[model samples]
Target: MDPIKKIAYNCRQATYLIEKQQISSITLKEKIELKIHLMGCSICKLFQQQSMLINKMASKHFADQHKHISLDTQFKEDLQQKINDRLHKN
Candidate 1:
């Protein structure tokens, strides 16, 4: 099998586990394999780490938002505009 395909498969699975929080937290063979791949691939490592960080931060942010004002639509719009601008630049 191609290395790119292998990495893509692992990335999809790793993201699911990261976002959904695997059913078995104690069993992390797949997670370990992902880390092993990350150790060698800087790009994959950055993507994995960034995704995990985003997931964690979003979870906590939503959990905390229950205390006060919620839904920052302007922030999201600004973010989208910035992203679009950057994408168009390329």
Candidate 2:
């Protein structure tokens, strides 16, 4: 199979790379592969665009929200204990 075709046909890899690229830089090979795949795949392109928009909106909202939010130590400890209890039960 052609290497480009292999990359282009794997929507799963294309989508994973789309998300990975947002968090950090993908390698040169990965960037090229993802570019090739996105050019041919409309669905993956839409997903990439939507992912960018969502990340942008979340960053904007969270930046403001973080300034106003705080949790006391006791509440944090109780929440952690409940999470631990749930994990142990599972």
Candidate 3:
């Protein structure tokens, strides 16, 4: 296989890299491969976006670990509704 082809990641690998990237630094080769893969793969790109958003939300929500906080009731209800809808759909 060509070197470039060998470096190209499948969707599963790309997603793993996407998640790994959030928690730690990937090697330069992996970064390059992931960047190239994301450029060509819209699905993986979307996954990366969603993962980043989730991480940002979680970080923000948990930033004050010692402080008391509560999830908004409206947000909880909305999330529950969405989950119920998806479960019924399947």
- The CA root-mean-square deviation of candidate 3, after full C-alpha superposition on the true structure, stands at 13.8
The CA lDDT at 41 in model 1 is 64
Tell me, by lDDT, which candidate is best: 2
Which tens-of-lDDT digit does each residue in 6-54 have in candidate 2?
9989999999999999999999999999999988999999999999999
Off by over 4 Å in 3: 1-9, 60-90
Q: Regarding TM-score, does 2 or 3 come out ahead?
A: 2
Candidate 3 overall lDDT versus native: 0.85
Flag regions of model 1 displaced more than 4 Å.
2-10, 17-23, 26-32, 64-66, 69-90
* CA lDDT, every model vs. true structure: 0.67, 0.93, 0.85
Candidate 2, number of clashes: 0
Instruction: Tell me which residue pairs clash in candidate 1.
Output: none
- Residues 4-90, model 1: lDDT tens digits: 457545766555555454333624765665665566666666776787778689889988977787669999899999999999999
lDDT of 3 by residue, 7-75 (tens): 464878889988888888999988999888887888888888898999888887788674777899999
